[model samples]
Target: MDSPNSARYSSRRSGETSRRHRWLGGCRDANPDNRSNVRASSQNIMSATLHTRESFDHSPVMAEEIVALFGEVPHGVVIDATLGGAGHTTRLLEAYPWMSVLGIDQDDMAIEHAAALRANSADIAQRLDVQRGRFDSIDTFLAQRNIDSISGALFDLGVSSPQLDMADRGFSYRQDGPLDMRMDTNAQLSAADVVTGYEVQQLTDVLRNNADERFAFRIAKAIVAARPIANTTQLAEIVANAIPAPARRTGGHPAKRTFQAIRIEVNKELDILPRALHDAIRATAPGGRVAVLSYHSGEDRIVKQAFRDAESNPLVQTVASPFQHHQSANKLVRKVKVAERPSAREIELNPRASSARLRVIEKVGS
Candidate 1:
């Protein structure tokens, strides 16, 4: 995979020009051979050398639900753990004028984009503090600031539409770009490393566990056979060809799951998520809320388990005396129900919101 700096240099040498546009750009190409051209055009719109503020434009999924959850909390700081494009954070700040937000994200581009937005809007600038780091280190950030607890926290999990739209970032399977998919540009491991290095079984496990891809083993075998896969388009083509034609026709895209699994592995997303949720619950004030918007079953499952474990002890308490026994507990922010999804209207407007599922929980005792 090419380094970001090199990608930028190459993009300029290729005579590409950046353009302002919304997120509806990259749909799958009908002609497999022309997929490379589609990726090149996307590259032109989001040149690696220049990421215009407009390039980060993304519509927050279930914006009203997020605002409602955080708005009900008493006045205090709110943490936006996955502050991609600051869409949710912006709405959150507007809804709760009395509250402030500490926005955290691993992506440098996201942080830069947020800073640019802050510079333009004085109201947003005054209330939002941007930080570049992973959410799992929330405790460290809080300690540095001498803060004890926050009123609420929001975790919007998975890749954002802007990231997918930017072909150089390589999150999209449909676009032909470098295999690099590190959320944090400074991160050592990349999707390219996983694709080029992982053993067949390891790759299979990643696909099966992270994405629930039914053809994990077959895909892994194909990936191994096509060693040193050059770009997203090539990898996608390989996976598509490896799958049974009938099966490939039904799913939205055959490469979607493989790309998701690779990105998850490269970023260690699932490994860090459990610790991040624990930190959020621990750092939140009593009665404070924690809301998560997950885009896939693997992420949703992790959130569900974390909420369940917080509400009940995994082991039975041996002591008979209730007064003597000590146990931690968590409360549901609202009544427990099936995770919320975007409305048909939202999906119609932004197809990316189709798979989103929102879940909320709260801290119980002090």
Candidate 2:
């Protein structure tokens, strides 16, 4: 994901190198145990632990369903527009070994990691064409690659586990680190800048718009008072201080909502999501399918709307009807099905995956 414009922060090399090296060392120690666990797990799904030394190996959520959804489509190309740890991409590649994939991501580390992982698997590595870009620019990316049609597409939206677990990324309010939450570190706007720069009204608007945080005004007021907040801990402490003792008793950490709002603002996540979904619909060939995995209300709303638009548009026929009619064009199940939540077993294994919802749509002929 090397970009000429993204290389301006060379001075931060020492810090990044130290952190990545530490991760690589830690990964080596856990490699055998993790690999053995993966092998012992259900079915013959290729899986591995993610690390700086290795390629993106984070496990996919709802992998079986994702692969199944795409498998129902015909042979051709598939696009993974949000190739986060390439978790879903890996699964997609494995399920359709004969199919080619154009995997895209804005994160430089993720792109590098995916490339490395692809190199490790001779079959998948050969079939993959990696690109570094945001999902919103799907059309431009496709044009650049001279790819106009795709059999299917998948977007496993939102942050990856590594981004959250790694303290330096500044995604999690729990980890003590800087407030820089840009998914693409190269982005000039950091979470710290948003927190310290945005006015109370602006901050409140962002919080309310992004996450519907009820205490947005209170949190915004606290943030403005705590100006010049440099790190994650400082911001988290101020947010915590804003919450009343009684309200904090039942709900989770007070800073959780504030941090989420700031991260969404920093990344322009909501703004790009709908456009990405539209581009995916346009790129998909007739009879193709698109699956989206969203973790929040805002993201799911965008997916829901974009899917509805695609299904209703005159250019594409809807596979499934709203009702369970016998003479439906494609099938009711192929229409925007009721969003499915992760199983309790999955939530038990990965608490972060609890809020995840899977949505699938199939495209009929124009």
Candidate 3:
């Protein structure tokens, strides 16, 4: 879930402006076929923001399926790991009257909005426990409340629509903004640090590892050469020039991959995911589940491996029942993989949902 950047064009790219668009030139592909699926997701997000007493229905990807998955689990508190606007949280609460949500997010804006939403109704306030924190530290949050086990956990990975639409937050290259793509406003590391500070090799790795950009090395070199990038618009221009013109004609935007990579790095989105998923699995009741909606290849890979390991690794322990006891034996888990793009309509309506992959694991034994 990510940002903006700015770097002046290098000598090789100085003259190519006339050949591109008036605004960011080739950066904003004029071809309708090249409209970015991921960026287009913001439109769906905006549409989904229908306000309700339960919470804002932020058009959570696969909300119905998520609710159904939790329906069979032992009814209790479910962790909304990435609680952007409490879309899934409120949905779950409404789905099962007995269900409650432990909502968490690092973004101050999201937390404040939820607080206001809760204040308007005492029911929401009692049913939802909003916390300002990262999902990777789920264990600590649970232990602090003396909570030992959960019914299920849901992680909708990636930046939310609100984060992307706010250009000042620096999650989009479509608008000109400072290089500050931090999910948590308080995080010391920002996109500014990433674009201006990272060395070529490190930047290249970030690009390739985070977004699978084919021109990682070339982009890294171009960015380094055009140092002191000031804003997202400037960064977009540099990235567009770094790639071959032919390639730019096809992708929705030349800077999408780079912006995503930098945002991932600034937030360390992948670093703590494995541990968080494992912890969520460990604390779940035998019949409970951990569901993840990963938006990119890197996140999906981590979720797949963590669940697979829990099923096969005997050393992995789990809570035996409720909050009563724990066991050291193998934690048996059944993996449930949903169909690729199960929601064709969802994808057509919300382009960003196209890349979303849902993975679920139900704990059967310990």
Candidate 4:
């Protein structure tokens, strides 16, 4: 993967530009991919405006699978842990008119959007509770509200559209925004800090371990030389410039893996995911279900392992029911099902759905 900067000469070639754009377009078809591009194209739009009607046309990943895990609508509260843009929340409210939702997000902007969404819908307005906090603190948040044991919970993990689309968030290398990629803008750490402050080896390890970037060492060397990266475009450019010409075009984007590594580090996303899933499972009542939609291998690994561990406990039993119907409460899905991707039709409509994978577990043994 040639860093965009290193290959600026080649990138300008008509053929190279076309190939890059085509690859980008393929990735963009998924909502997750769109968010990456939105992060890259952040300069033109406000973060709040980044997620307008046009950006939200695609359905969420595995909507039916999630609904099935949730089973027939139960008469209790449910949590949407990540609650990005409230897509899943909207569906839940529609499917189960009686259910109340506690939609939580680390990002204040997401909270704002969810609140507005609820306000616009009379039914959701009455049933929704929006909180601005990390999902890892879900138990504490619920306790504060005098609520315990929700009937269901959902986690749509990873960057939301508006976060990437808005350049100020600095999540995408493609978009030129301040190198600040904090999911919670209030957080002190930012992508700029990583690019400018970390040691070469440290940065290399981050790219290699977190993102599996093959050219981690070279990219790290380039980034160290281009210190004090002020914004997304410059950092991405530096990374792109680092790769040898032969190695540059190997991957779709020379900076894709490096950017992913930096963003994950900036947000502390992987670090907290396992803990959040475990806590979510514990927070729900026995018979309650927790469904997670992960967009990448890193996120899916944590969800898969956590659910697997839960099923091994004597307290948790396997749900033996057929796939389409609801399984008994107190029983979880027996195995980690294949990672489900967006349908071809869905991918066409919302390119961002491509990388999505959904997994679920139900609490048993009261």
Candidate 5:
């Protein structure tokens, strides 16, 4: 989830290295002896060492579910598309002795952190190979690696916990920082450019499309009026002040959606997501799986549509309109019915997991 970076909009879209070659370090197993433990059914599935955050302390959302989702795939290289802190990758490596992971992330911090993490264990260090780049560029990555396809891929979308916790990243509206929200620190576009550059309509569209901000127009207008908006706090204040008082009181923060919109614009998150998903689907071997853990409506809708598009023949979908529930019969991919919500206990333990939504599809044949 390349989101706002924290509990709210943890969606950060930054730019950096066109390619981060490898960050194959590891995490010390928190539960070394109990890596294979699993509780009852999926109701509250928990893996002893698998669910806890890595030494990096960033927990992966729906860890148990992620493992189970990929468990059925043909054992081979699985792509951890958003390898923030490598929590899910570590879990997957521990759970599936036969599997290796090709982790990908644009954030240098995540890649560096993962590199250092793998140093703790040679097992994962040997199995995990990380690359720094937008996940959507999967095609280029596979070509460079001399790999033809993958067994599975996982997309955990959003800004990472560390990104939000650190005020310098400018992802938290509650804190004051420079208006920078590029997931890749090296990326050219920054939140500052978006806040000060986009016109009212462009900005409004971004707000509406990225985060579905109801006060998109008002917020955009207010932002334009407050030209030299200084930093995150000021932007947050302006956004809050522009919203009707009643609406301000409900959402956790009036600026959450605004920040999300800006981050998405800065990173071009929505624009490239479809290509990324489709690329992953295309690169998947027969019986392989592609799983996504999106954090918001916009991300979810795109994931749903992409999966539907893969499942349905384009010619047949035109007729699907008359029958809204029309089921498409195809052989390329099939949905994996999964209960993806965070368990109440999981939410209680990590509130950031509240908005996580996981979707999975399996490649049926070539």
Candidate 6:
């Protein structure tokens, strides 16, 4: 999503034309018998380049469930609020041919990538509208587009795989890169700023609340001491060293939580999410649906509470009250049930999807 004050970054690369031709040539020369290896090679080549359309290689988490929930919405525009790699948007568009998608993303690279994908596919290109903005501004975007209400909305929260795998983006704890983790590259705050600028207590709260890091205090202190921390690797190493040895051995990576914490703070992810959810619910028409695919506990908690609050609409109370004697009132959407997580098989195929939790709610009354 485009930040309010930040300058937009150029999406074009100098050798993009040549690189595209090279990628196409590689595709054409691949042997059908060894297609799997060729596909992997192509992905690697794509990743090596700057932010090309193909570089955003991400598998949408719980794609089937997302489609099932949103596809049934009556013909109208569906908002893909996150639009990471356009994975969920493409699936929804394909499943419900009548439904168009408004794909919103903070990352300009994602918008460019979606446009390129749209260009290649005639049907999707005709129906997909790529917009550069954050989900929190969903209402304003729809208003500017002259759209009144939407059939469905989908929010697949958190960073995409390409964002993590691309070392330069600095979302990954494994790879060494610049300490930049802004989802909207144009955003002012970065991981480096949080690490170097935040006071020890503030940093500790960020780590503790964002990721529930047990050694938040120790990690925060270490980061402060290591003040001029340069890149992702340096911060990751400090976080790892600060944590107790036994604790570090069991978790996937010691720096994983800390990195997630910093990234969340830098992006202000949690703060805006509640507003975005409310905007989505308000924008959706009666009987329409809203689905959220969240990766972390904090995100899920926010989603859960928002849905619960919506379900207990004041209108319902007003309508039922004897004193009010209201015949009809606008009833908000109710949560279908608890959130759904990916199965073991899906997790095996795409480990990045392991933490995904999908919660769906549908508009109930006029």
Residue-level lDDT of model 5, residues 2-67, one tens digit each, is 236455222222233112212222333334455445222211212322223222343467776777
Name the top lDDT candidate: 5
Query: Residue 249 in model 5: shift from native, Å?
Result: 1.0
- For 1-366, candidate 4 gives per-residue lDDT tens digits of 212121100111123232112111111123353344333222222232223433233355555456556654356899999776666665565456567889998887767666656544555567779999998898888899998678878888777654665556777667788888787989999887899999999999999777778789989988898776777888878888987888787757778778778888988888988888888778777767777777766777777788788877645433322163344444444443565665687655555666776666666644
Q: Per-candidate TM vs. native?
A: 0.80, 0.82, 0.80, 0.80, 0.83, 0.81
Candidate 4 residues lying further than 4 Å off, grouped into runs, are 1-58, 317-333
**Clashing pairs in model 6?**
1-105, 1-106, 1-107
Better of 2 and 6 by lDDT: 6
lDDT (tens digit, per residue) of candidate 6 on 262-304: 8889899999999999888888887677888778888888888
How does candidate 3 score on lDDT? 0.70
In model 6, where is the ten-residue run with the lowest total lDDT? 1-10
Over all chains combined, what TM-score does candidate 4 have? Answer: 0.80
- lDDT over C-alpha atoms for residue 241 of model 6: 95
Which structure is stronger by lDDT: 2 or 5? 5
The residue-by-residue lDDT of candidate 3 on 1-366, one tens digit each, is 222221111012233332111111111112244233323323322222222312212356666567667877898889999887666665576557677788899988768766755665565677789889999889999999888899989888878765775678888899888999999989999999989999999999999999889999999999999999999999999999999999988767889889989988999998989999989988888778788878778878888788778867543323312222333333332233432333786655445566777777667654
Per-model C-alpha RMSD: 11.3, 7.3, 11.3, 9.5, 7.2, 9.3
| Residue 293 displacement in candidate 5 (angstroms) | 0.4
Evaluation by TM-score, superior candidate among 2 and 4 = 2
Task: Write the residue-wise lDDT of candidate 2 on 1-366 in tens digits.
Answer: 111111100111124454333222112221354345432221222522232334222236766567667766778889988776566665566556557888998888767766666655555566677888889998998899898788878888776655676678887777788889888988999997899889999999998988878889998999899898989989889988888888766557777777777888898988998888888888888768777877778878888888778767755533322222232554432343567776786556555566777776666653
